[model samples]
Target: MRATIIHGAGDVRIETVPDPVILEPTDAIVRIVRACICGSDLHPFHNKPAGSDPRAIGHEFIGVVEDTGSAVRTVSRGDFVIAPFVWSDGTCEFCREGLFTSCLHGGDWGDENVGGGQGEATRVPQADGTLIPVPGITEDSELLPSLLTLSDVYGTGYHAAITAGVRPGETVVVIGDGAVGLLAVLSAKQLGAEKIILMGRHEARTNLGREFGATDVVSARGEEGIAQVRELSGGHGAHRVLEAVGFLPAYEQALGVVRPGGAISRVGVPQYVEAPAGRVLFRPNVTLTGGVAPVRKYIDTLLPLVLDGTVNPGRVFDMTVSIEDVPSGYVAMDERRALKVLVKP
Candidate 1:
C-alpha cells in the first residue's frame, strides 16, 4: 500500500506502508478512492520539527468499505462512504446531543498511534458513527470532491453559519477565503442570509465566493477590510459574522465586522492566541460560539443538498493530483496557488 507521509517540515513523500485491517468490533477497513490535503495538514507540514518520522498526512477521504467489524451496522462491505475527519463513538452522550466532535471516545487521525485515511487502505474506528454512507454514489468520480467536503471543510463552513444563527434577510460577513471560508459563504446563502460579504483578496477565490452566493467581496486587508464589511452593512456591521480562518487577525476582523448584539461563529482552529473576552463581553450583547465542526451532525442535512444539486461545494477544488503527487498538492495549497486540492488514490 502507498500513503503520503510527511517526513518533516516542507517534505512530503508517497511511500509504501502496511495495509490496514479491522482492529476493533466497531472498526472498518476502507480502500481509499479519493483524498485531499487540508489546511490543517499544513500546520505540521511547516512547523513540526525536521526528521520527525513520516506519518500519514490526510484526513478527508471517500472510499469503498472493504471490511467491517462485528459491531458495525450502519455500513457494510461494498458501501460507498465518507469518513468524517473526527472519529466518534455514536453511543456517547455528546454524540447523542449532536456534538460528535466532542464525543467521549472521539479522536483525530494522523496523531501518534492513529492510522490516517490518506493511504491505500486505512482503519476507521466506530465506523457506524463516523462514516456516512452515500447511497447510489459509487461510480461518480466527480462527486468525490463534494463528498469529501462533508468530512471537514463544508461541514466546518456549515458550522460557522449555524453557530452565528444566520437567519433570513440577515447580513452576514465571512472572514477568510480558504475552502472553509468559501463554503461558509455557500452555507450562509443556503441558510437564507440575504446579504453575504466575503473578505478575501484572491480574485479566484473571491470570484468563486460570489458564484456560491457572496453578495459583496471585500479585497482590503486589515482595518481596511473591516471597514469595507461595515460599509456593506450600512455602517452598522453585519448581523452575523463567520470566522473561518483560525488566527488572531482573522478573529479580530470577524469581531470588528459584526454589529453589536450580533453573533460571531468561529470555526477556525485557533493556533496560539486567545480571543479577547473583554471586548466581546463588555460591548454589545455579542454571542460567541464555535469549535471543531461536528461533521456527523451535518452529514444528513448536507448530503441531501448535494444529492439534489442545490449546492456544489466541490467548486472550491482548484486542483486534482494523484496520491503520489500529494507533496505538490500540499505546496500548492500552502502557497495559495490552489483553493483546494483533491487527491486520487
Candidate 2:
C-alpha cells in the first residue's frame, strides 16, 4: 500500500507502507477513495522537529469500508463513509453530549500509533462510533467534494459560525479567505446574516467569497481593515466576527472588528499560545470562544443540505490531483497557488 509520510519539515514523500488491519473489535479498515491536504497539515510540514521519524501525514478523507470488526454493526462491508478528523467511541459522556472531539476514549489520526487519512487504506478504531455512513451513494458520486468536507473543513467552518452565534440580519465580519474562511462566509449567510464582510486580499479567492455570500470584501489589513469594517457597520464594528485565521494578527483583527457584546468564533487551527488579552476587551465587552469542531456532531445536520444541493461547500477545492501527486498538492496550497487541494487515491 502507498501513503504519505512526513520525514521532516518540508519533506513529504509517497512511500510503500504495510496495509492496516482491524486491531480492535470496534475497528474497521477503510480503503481510501479520496483525501486532501489541510492547512493545519502545513504547521508540522514547516515546523516538524529535525531527525523525526517519517510519520503519517493528513487527516481528512472519505472512503469505503473494506472490512469491519465483529462489533461494528453501524456499518458493514462496502459502505461509503466519512471519518471525522478525530476518532472516538460513541459511548462516552462527551460523545453523548456531541463533543466527540473530547471523548474519554477518543484520539486523533496522528497521535502515536494511530495512522492518518492520506493513504491507500487505514485502520479506523471504534468504527461504529467514529464512521458516518453515506446512504444512497454507495460509491463515489458527484457530491464527492462536499461529502469529503464533512471529514473536517466544512464542519469546521460551520462550527466557527455557530459558536459565534451569528444572528439573522446581523452584520458579520469574517477574517481570512482560505477554504475554511470562505466557507465561514457561506455559513454566516446560511444562518441569515444580512451583511458579510470578508477580509482578504486575493482577488480570485475573495471573488469566490462574493459568490459564497460575502456582501463586502475588505482588502485592507491591521487598523485600516478595522476601520473599513467599522465604516460599513456604522462605527460600532460588526455584530459578530468569525476568525478563520488562527495567527496573532488575524486573531487581533477579529478582536478589533467585533462590536461590544459580540462574539468571535475561531476554528482555523490555532498557531499561537495565550490569545492576547487586548486593552479593548474590557471597554467593548467582546466574548471569545471556539475549539476543535465537534465535526461528528455537525455531520448529520449538514449532510442533508449537501445532498439536497441547498449548499455546495465543495467549491473550496480549487485544485485536484492524483493521490500519487499528493506532495505537489501540498505545494500548491502552501504557495497560495491553490485555495484547497483534492486528492483522488
Candidate 3:
C-alpha cells in the first residue's frame, strides 16, 4: 500500500508502506474511497522542526469497510463509513457525555503504528465508536463530498457554533475564511443567526461565505476589521465570534469583535499559548469556548441534513488531487490557492 508521510516542514511524500490489519478486536480496516487535506495538517507542515523522523499523516476520510475484527458488530465488511479524525471507545464516560474526542481509550490516526487517511487503507481503532456507517447512501453517491465533511470540518464548525451558544436573531462574526471558517458561517446560519459577518481577505472564498449565509464580509485586519464588525453589529460588536484560523491575529480579532457578554468559540486548533485573558475577558464577561470538535458526537445530527440537502458544506473543497499528488495539495492550501483539497486514492 502507498501512504502519505511528512518528513519535515514543506515536505510531504507518497511511498509504499505495509498494509494495516485489525490489531484489536474493536478495530476495522477501511479502504480509502475519499480523503482530504485538513488546515490543521498545515501546522506541522509549516512549523515541524527539521531533522525529525518522518511519520504518516492525514485524518479526514470516508471509506468502505474492507474488514473488521471479531468484536466489531455495528458494521460489517463492505459497509460505507465515515471515520472521525480520532477513534474512541463508545463505552467511555466522556463519550457517553458527547465528548468522544476525550474518550479514555481514544487515539488519532497517522501515528507510527497507525495508517494515515490519505492512503489505500487504514486501521481504525474502536470501529463501533469511531466509524459512522452511512445508510441508504452508496460510495458513489453525489453526496460523498458532503458526507466527507462530516469527518472534521462540518462537525467542527457546528461545534464552534453550538459552544458559542448561537441563537435565533443573534449576530455572529466568523474570523478566517478557510473551509472551517466558511463552514462556521454555515453553522451559524443553520442555528438561525440573523446576521453573519465573515472576516477574510480572499474574495473568491468570502464570496462562498456569502452563499453560506454571511451577510457581510470584512477583509480588513486589526483595528479596521474590528471597527467594521462593530459598525455592522450596531456598535456593540457581534453576539458571537467564531475564530477558525489557528493564529494569534485571528484570536485577537475574535477578542476585539465580541460583545461585552458574548462568546468567542475557537476551533482552529490554537497555535498560540499565552493569549490576552485579563482586561479583555475580565471586564467584558465574555465566555471563551471551543476546542477540537468531537466530530463523532455531531455526525449523527449533521448527517441527516447533508442527506436532505439542507446544507452543502462540501463546497469548501475547491481542488482535487490523486494520492501521488498530495504534496501539491498541501502547497495549494498553504499558498491559499485552494480552500481545501479533496484526495482520491
Q: Give the best candidate by TM-score.
A: 3
Candidate 2 TM-score over all chains jointly? 0.98
lDDT digits (tens) for residues 88-197 of candidate 3: 88888999999999999888897657888989999998899889898777867989899999999999999999999999999999999999999999999999999999
Worst 10 residues of 1 by lDDT: 273-282
**Across residues 1-345, which tens digit of lDDT does each residue of candidate 1 receive?**
888888889988888877787778999998888888888888888887887677877888889999999989999999999998988988899999999989899788776555676778788888988888887887466677788899899999999999889999999999888999999999999999999999988999999999999999999978888888888899989989898888888888877888988988989888756567785745788888888899889988999888777889988898999877888888899999988998888
Every candidate's lDDT:
0.87, 0.89, 0.93
Instruction: Report RMSD (Å) for each prediction in the order shown.
Output: 1.3, 1.1, 0.8
Candidate 3's TM-score reads: 0.99
Best by lDDT: 3
274 Cα displacement, candidate 2 (Å)? 2.9
Order of quality (TM-score): 3, 2, 1
Residues 100-207 of candidate 2 have per-residue lDDT tens digits of 999999898856666778888889989988999997775558899999989988888889899999989999999999988998899899999999999999999999
Roughly what TM-score does model 1 have, to 2 decimal places? Answer: 0.97
Residue 130 in candidate 2, Cα distance off native in Å? 0.8
Residue 290 Cα positional deviation in candidate 1, in Å, after optimal superposition: 1.1
Name the runs in model 3 displaced over 4 angstroms: none
